[model samples]
Target: MGGSYEDAIALLDTRRRVRRPSGALAKDAARDAGLKPEFRVGGEALRGKPGIVGMSGWMEELGHSPADVAALNIIHVAGTKGKGSTCAYIEALLLAHGAATGWPRSVGMYTSPHLLVPQERVRISGTAIDERGFAKYFFEVWERLFDGDTATESQKGERPRYLQLCVLVALHAFIKEGVGAVVLETHHGGEYDATNFVEKPVVTVVTPLGRDHVKQLGPGMKDIAWHKAGILKSGAVAISSAQEEGLEEVLRARAEERGVFGGDVKVVTGTEEPGVQGVKPDVQMGNCAVAVVAVRAFLERMRGEVLSEESVRRGVEGFKWPGRFQVVERGGGRERWWCDGAHNEMSIGVAGRWFVDGLEEGDRARVLVFSQISDSRDTEAVFRCLAESLKGSGVQLVIFTTYDPDQTFSASMSLDQQVATTTLPSLDVYERVWKELHPNAEVRFELQLAEALNLAKRIGEPGAGVDVLVTGSLHLVAGTLWWLGEGVGGAR
Candidate 1:
């Protein structure tokens, strides 16, 4: 009562408040005497419940026992990057297997940081759960978690954040739907993430680790590897894509500690062999190799048989995880747009290299639309990566903006886009970086997502190999795709 809403947000944000939302009934929950629970912080808790030591109790408080989750078979995937694609591969493999046997007819896949829509996090039979069903199951879980005797310690003031709530809701949906298999991706590192409480998984996968999530997962790849390794369980097989130099040893040690013997730890090396034409060259074959081996291991362990090479290949080849390096042409527009959610240095570097490769050693009228998450302070590095990618190629235009509405969030777009007035101070920081790197390429700062797309369209020269790239963040890619009218509800 003593402070304004903005003041309250500032105070709670500065406090050691949880990273994600606390699912607490912020208003009714008692904090200290007459003090409110700080609704502003409560809202942020939905986004970042900071440290991750609360999921075990929160699951029980939600009336979901360990056995409840165990009812559905799960393959937990964790890593800094490529986790979503690996999860997609695992899910596709399970779905193909499910169609063949009565064992698992429905597969549910859950991944974090939804590309576009909120429902993208939870998919049933390879499609987003319908809006009605998502809301129904969502509030049902919310009620059971906070209402009556089911109130969690969070209710006393430790509410769950967005990722935890989404994971719980997804688990609820999968169990209720009687899904045969669920592919679960950890929100952050595995050890402290909510999904780590799965108790048991048929198999655990560590996609190639990198330097992202530095604020929470610590700085180096080893520290991040330590956290990602938490998904490994004693009896479950462990799998990993080739990690940078010494990180593989760290993964092996973690797997060994989790009780996976030497033979059980599968390390993949460039599994995407030559002659794979339809796939993007930048797509890591190593991650796919990890996914395939994981699927084979899970099937042999759980069903006592391995899928045929043909079936596994089909599954992996057919898997569609959007917003990686996706190309789209809007309304027969003259320019071809390629989009990748490569926010970190490594990923952006890969995306940039791919862009250069596609150019055939020639320059083009290329446009780069980039935005970074507000919290990550590595935009300078990202700009450098882009510069490295476009080194030989002639770049025409560069745009900087927030994930904010250059395009308004509406029904035509995702209603869940949650419009807010936030400025992109990072653009100013990046502007300096761009001048240092690409002194000639024109850089314009736009506040609206719509304006950015429109500007690219008007100025983009058609025909002679003009390329427009949207990278930096998945949120940016998702918003751009939605603007291009790719939000039609379907399995893809």
Candidate 2:
């Protein structure tokens, strides 16, 4: 009866009064408690979002079938720009107060578009998951979905996109590692994203809303806001940074449904406070402020108390998002490489301000290394913002490059995920934008980012003020780092 599939089914059929479900089905039953029978979308009593994980019930299955996420105290965040920075701050705050709170220092987080390395998406205690750990958990998640066998090369590519799988692994690894808390960052809309499957999180935070990801999310700001607010659930504390007029309206309306608006849990809009320590260096003051409040709320949820201001301040001071406006040393510490993931107009404007503000304070040869990461960043608009933001910075040279990972270095990232690090990126579209912005502007289109970096260093003068402003796609920052022999910690 137990030896063959037919015999087992025959035995069950003869003896069974009613079939009892277990494994994935039992886990799904457990998670069914959180689901509203009539699924709602943005406060509207909608029937369902067919593709969304909330309705699909995939998360419930993922939770118990292979790993359980029920006990993980997670701080979930979704936004356009500062999601990564905000998550970093939360992790830093947790690490800073780990000993005091008796919290596990193995802080876990999952972010997207790792600057140069893929494992950077899954960090543990402030470092990328090493190759061995990543491979172990990576295949564990992968194999679980495919009946416990290694995926072929073709099957691997056909699997979920790299970011989605990385998230699954991060959640799985965090559970296995016994991490006390997790900071989950979503790369897309709250309701529709794969990471949204997280059943329960102590806190959910959103940074300032922006107009990127229009194709997938929607055409308008409100649409984007509604999608982002999907992360909100009943009885969960929610926090947000200042939003534009349209963005605020939608977010507030949705938050109202959950009784989050105008409550202590919602907190004030992050714009009112210069909440983080010193000058905000990550992306914007609003984002840093939002992170501060969100981390405080998370700490309160985890430990039933808020961390001391000094501890929070110390974490904020030391926190740095790898490719977000980071000033790195290249060329034997002589040249300054200011790298940022200004892949869109909103971020480009900020990056331009940081660069121009620096140049104004002192005289330096500032070279602009820019490229379009995706169409989400309208090339024309991005170039226009850069042109206006850096109008008088005397940017002597502009280099447009790609983020092709294969050309730069052999990375150990699973699924052979590649960045546009080589010289083959389509530079003509961006070059055309540059030409229109500065018909007389000096520029170069290189297939290899490494060549572009070498060129920038060569074209600039040797002095403290010589800055190579490597601000465009975050992938470009990672490529530049790897090209300059940095970021080897993870990809290697």
Candidate 3:
């Protein structure tokens, strides 16, 4: 049953059934265990130790030693926002420079929370591994770890979690394919993320920091910064996007403590390089800046030369990271959809403003489709911020929906039942919060993403000249694209 790609996906899905503890139970357990009260985001509740402590042993079981993993020459990147886009820029830079650099390195990129399929997490030279290739590597690692007769000591007692398995499969694929350089994005934070097991990285990057993953990585911005800065080991060249106020101090201290290459973190101002033509929007300019600096450091370390401005221009011009600030036109461009995965408080406002700035001078109708499932973020605050940004845009309607496209609403069903069956909030908190900020605006609630998108499209019909902004969660954005028959091509 686990031989085919579909079967492998099913096998992977089975491992995702670990039940998260209830809020009260989790708080109590965290207190008793001397752990941060918010450190129970996933399967960590069932494990006795941090996940990172066991990563090396697991890699050894898969026939790769620590030295071999380090030889892959990874660029470890971690942050709350822009890490994925930054990685995309770095990948583009390497790809552009490969020809001039003698084509010496086969660049690989490993990112998480795929928009479509599991295979999207691993890519070689800009293309995702095909279904047959993904299945081959997935089964090899699965059998090696779970096979009763030949299982390693660590695996004989327990199997790797979903994310851990994904990392292993990616590393296995990269090694087997002889990938010379890798751009690795941290799934959560740096210190304990499974990808941090690569003790030696050629360069380490920390993009703009913010309060995200509060349940697992934070009680404050400084704590989150510490976790992100953990990837700065003694050997790597440490770099970071200009952090908010004191967070840069945290990163610098960490770099000094780790005895990193320069004994200090190089904070990059977005002005370090001239802006690329296609790289508009203030936020992406910062991401591009950080990528340029990181790539420069990587080139100097690996080839003893500075990165060429032409290569940077080419990479920035060619870079594409979908769902960040993506614009999709439907109904032959009359219905413009501005989609972004800005779930945190800061990013919400940034994305909202960007959407508003793109609006034309005419009396254009605006639509907003938003949903967020995580209880850890300030969903109400996000709504308020978004409402403030779109004040002058004349938003005709707002649709709040869940990420699942198959969900259906039934008034006959109890609210408790609805909450139990789907990812919708237990109450109408989001809608209420939004209304408080914009009493005159009309709002509707949909149980599924497909219905929300359909309702938005109808209200924003081609002749109406409407602009729609979909945000609040990556899952919501990805689900929107999937239901629209869009593929995870481009920069994601």
lDDT of candidates 1 onward, in order = 0.71, 0.66, 0.78
lDDT of 3 by residue, 401-479 (tens): 8764223222232222323236667337777777777788898888856777878888755455778899988877876
TM-score of 2: 0.80
Q: Which 10-residue span in candidate 3 carries the lowest summed lDDT?
A: 406-415
Clashes of each: 29, 11, 1
Over the stretch 1-492, how does candidate 2's per-residue lDDT look in tens digits?
Answer: 013323222322232222212222233432453445343333333222212333223333354432357577778899887788778877877887785666756788888756654567778878888756766766565455533344456544234443455666677788789887888888767866767776567788988778787655556778778888878765668887777777776766777776652443353453444336355544555666777777677776667776777776667665767777777875565688887878677788888888767654565567898866564446667767887787777777898766653232344432224434334445666677666766777988776666777788886555654688887676677767766666546221
C-alpha positional error of residue 83 in candidate 2 after TM-score superposition, expressed in Å = 0.8
lDDT of 1 at 83: 84
Candidate 1 displacement at residue 106 in angstroms:
1.3
Mind giving the per-residue lDDT tens digits that candidate 1 earns over 223-273?
A: 778879978898788888888899988888888787873445688776553
Displacement of residue 269 (Cα, Å) in model 3 is: 2.0
* Candidate 2 regions with alpha-carbon error over 4 angstroms: 1-67, 149-161, 258-275, 331-333, 360-363, 405-440, 461-465, 488-492
Alpha-carbon RMSD of each model: 7.6, 9.6, 5.4
